[model samples]
Target chain A: MITMTRETLFNLAMMAALILFPLWAWLADEPFMITLATKAVILALAGVGLNIALGLGGLVSLGHAAFFGIGGYAMGILASHAQNYTPLIETPFLIEGTKSMPVIWLVAVICSGLAALAIGALSLRTSGVYFIMITLAFGQMLFFFTISWPAYGGEDGLSIYVRNGFPGLNTLDPIQFYGICFALLALVLFFAARLARSPFGLALNAARQTAERVETVGISPYKLRLTAFVVSGMITGLAGALFADLNRFISPTMFSWQTSGEIMIFVIIGGVARLFGPVVGAVIFIALEHLLGGLSDYWHIYLGVLLLLIVLFARGGVIGTLTGREVAHD
Target chain B: MTDPMMTDPVLETRGISKTFGALQASKDISLTLMPGEIHALIGPNGAGKSTLIKQIAGGLRPDAGQVFLQGREVTGLDTPARARLGLGRTFQISALAMEDTVLQNAVLGALGASGRPFRFWRAALGDKDLRARAQDALERVGLQEHAATRTAELSHGQRRQLEVAVALTLRPKAFVMDEPMAGLGTGGSLRLTGFLDGLRAEAPILLVEHDMDAVFALADRISVLVYGEVIATGTVEEIRANPDVRSAYLGDEA
Candidate 1:
């Protein structure tokens, strides 16, 4: 029964922009613009994943890139084995690499979800700064572990010789690839919207607002948070899989704390808990990086200033300010 | 008066004591809440009334004691486990989900007893049974009209009523209410006193309160706690006539 507000309208417009810009780029034979749009959608998807934990569960995890990197490695390791015509593992039953994008995405989600389960189990035992530090440490551990892993390229990154195949399309086509990423972002946004209204979502929101009250209600906040964190990791892992395919490269940099920071940035800039907040935030972030990066070598200084202004003047991120609703408490 | 030697108390605390570093927050206090009776625990501030309630509600562990609900030891249980065993609670400071709607808050309380809140794909609004239970609880607290209203927007009295509504859905064997009448106006207090008086017929209440008027009007039996010790345990008139209680706690205040 909730009516569409200006924020919802803005969300719709941004989604349309994502599609139209990529389509326009394809028509104009501007491959770079299409690539840029794809990156934005992929990153937005990752932010949507984080919002489930940060905005809904109030779990401020700083190591989401570990999930992102798991997805990237899932794609990288599989594609590399397929390219070299080698099986992934020589166990009792041989395990082979996959060239299917869907299969790669599945593997990515599973790996990220399990990793999240383990990390969240330990990190969630602590709250506030301790949680932030524990998650950061986990991310760093993975980053170093990947760096020392010589089988997948060690400090040197792994590259996919060819983009993984979609069921019925040439993924090499800039427009087609862009379409997949955009559609996925839309899907996760839809899922996130559904989740925010579900019973689990209500309990998670309650836990975020009042942990003691939630406990009295007989729902464990820890269990709710762990579930949200794992789901978040799964979604981000999917996004990471696509990201690696987009660039045809995976490295320790994907697991870096800087990537985790950027992912958190997308959620904050978009509007925490706003369904399409991440999408809008990702669009702005990509626009800034592209436009400003073209204008000045030290575009980050300007980006920093802009981010500060938004944080200072706008209580809610872009979508929230436009919508006139700070957080989706509904 | 009820038999003082009754062995089958509804909710009993045996020799309960708790210490926080150098502070003896709760001393050896044994109390009983018989079925269908309001056992009001009244004390001055810093008398450790809150600590006793926390131990009963499983929020705090008594260094030495046993909390029994229906004669089953529950001292080792955590808050959630104790809540599942039918120990319903309301907070003095209005512990509620501020962002959630009245119905959502009610539903969360029911969600624990219902035992299946892990349904993520289906919309909560579509669940007819859960909504019905939530609506039913709201009706009990007279908040049925504001079912969709955000909890933050409710008045202080309304919020307290909603807390009762939330607890009612727990189907509790006993109620651990902390100052249910703390912020109520005279009218609201009277309304709640009537509600609590009626509520005892379903389950006993362990009320921790400072409001003497409400306590005298609602409590079936009164227990005075002073500096972590129970000064007097008796009926309303008995406590009123006790000189020791008059000097220590009631202080001619009651």
Candidate 2:
């Protein structure tokens, strides 16, 4: 059994500080910083979900934003109907009311899981670049559909009058909202860690490296990849729900290819294929975006340049450099 | 050669042939394996030894004829499907999970006997019985000490032994090995022969090997092939004494 070392201890310390950093905003009365940190935490959770597919399964899904948006829209549309106390459509039959946070999350997971199953079943038929393109196409399809639809805010997006309610917590408080984001982020990250060490994870890795050998052992690579893909989509979908709640809004922008690219950037920047790599990447990415955006209007150009430099020179991303473990291998 | 009363041959190939467009890779080949016998399949390069093994292992479908495992038709099954039915194989190029530990690779194969491996989750790795079984297979090939080592670190001989360990994990009724003695040094060849001898009582082995000495040493029966057709099938002494076998293959020794 692998035991936690000083490095893990340090990581835990860092995580604890991260969790409390938003609390400091509450203490200092900086609502903007609290909101920004909460957004970061939600995005980090989504990145953690992507890490399961990309880092562990060697699946580079360029359409994760579809799952994210599906999740956001599930919550947004459900909440909208519930708040108005009306049906989504005439349906010629029945009406469905809006749901609370837990119900919304459950709905979001099921919706995203179904979408993932469909996408994964088709996309997994092809490998490498083809798989990437298939996912991107599905994501873009959803993105455009959301943008074109005139209902439920469409391209203009939807807004929640009140944030979705959690049990026994005054979520209206910025710090409380931040606590929810932090707790979910930590929990999902823990799940990702557990998944990477599981027998399913081992089979996924085996499929990635030597698919023929994996088949000889009686595990189908297609089944393994599809299962991983669906689980990954659900996790990312959960992150999307939190993200929509964080902003009290949902938009077609959530499903855009650019969002997909940004999430990939977080995974790669922190380090690709490492256990704590996505978390590190997300934290560093938010830091750079915050600090650089504060300095100039053209902050994105610098972000692009920084990413290029890292890709060209660093190879393994920051966590790989820090731990001296090769990122690509892990 | 007239001994046809054998009890349900563990593996049987009947008129099995494979064609790749213009090329007839394998042609109407028929062979039978009885349990507790070491069957040596000898052929020159491009004589369809690998192709024939692939058909038997269900890596390829024969254009004509069928393959049977323990009297059950298995020609339609895929590699993993055939494997679950107790047909284990070692690849020509040493197909193994190079990144995984030797113990992990063996456990992966051994886990099949119990049921689906990935489904068991935490209990699979923690099961003492499974580990004991994995260790026993490793010990048969003299690789018990190398269990924890990654496959990439093993010497060529050791890697071959590891493959044998993986093949033996399921307590297979028949093992189809493609060039099991390839790339082994003198000592390595001896070790593989010794290991095969130990396994002969437990399972029937279909060996495709270039090492004539090891083949003659371990084979209860030898099948000689030239241009995808079996020239002769008999005891090693009978094959060694046959003039056609000598002119086609053993002429190199002369």
Model 1, span B1-254: residue lDDT tens? 45653447879999999998898888899999998899999888999999999999988999998999888999998998888888899999988898788888998888877877788998876788888888998998899999989999999999999999999988899999999998899999989999999999899999998889988988889999998999899999999999989999777565
Give the TM-score (vs. native) of candidate 1: 0.96
**Span of 10 residues, lowest total lDDT, candidate 2 chain B:** B116-125
Chain B TM-score (each prediction, in order):
0.96, 0.93
The local lDDT score (0 to 100) that residue A283 gets in candidate 1 is 82
Candidate 1 chain A, poorest ten consecutive residues by summed lDDT? A321-330
In model 2, the runs with Cα more than 4 Å from the true position are A89-95, A312-315, A326-330, B1-6, B120-124
Best by DockQ: 1
Scored by lDDT, the top model is: 1
**Which regions of candidate 1 are displaced past 4 Å?**
A326-330, B1-7
Candidate 2: TM-score of chain A is 0.94
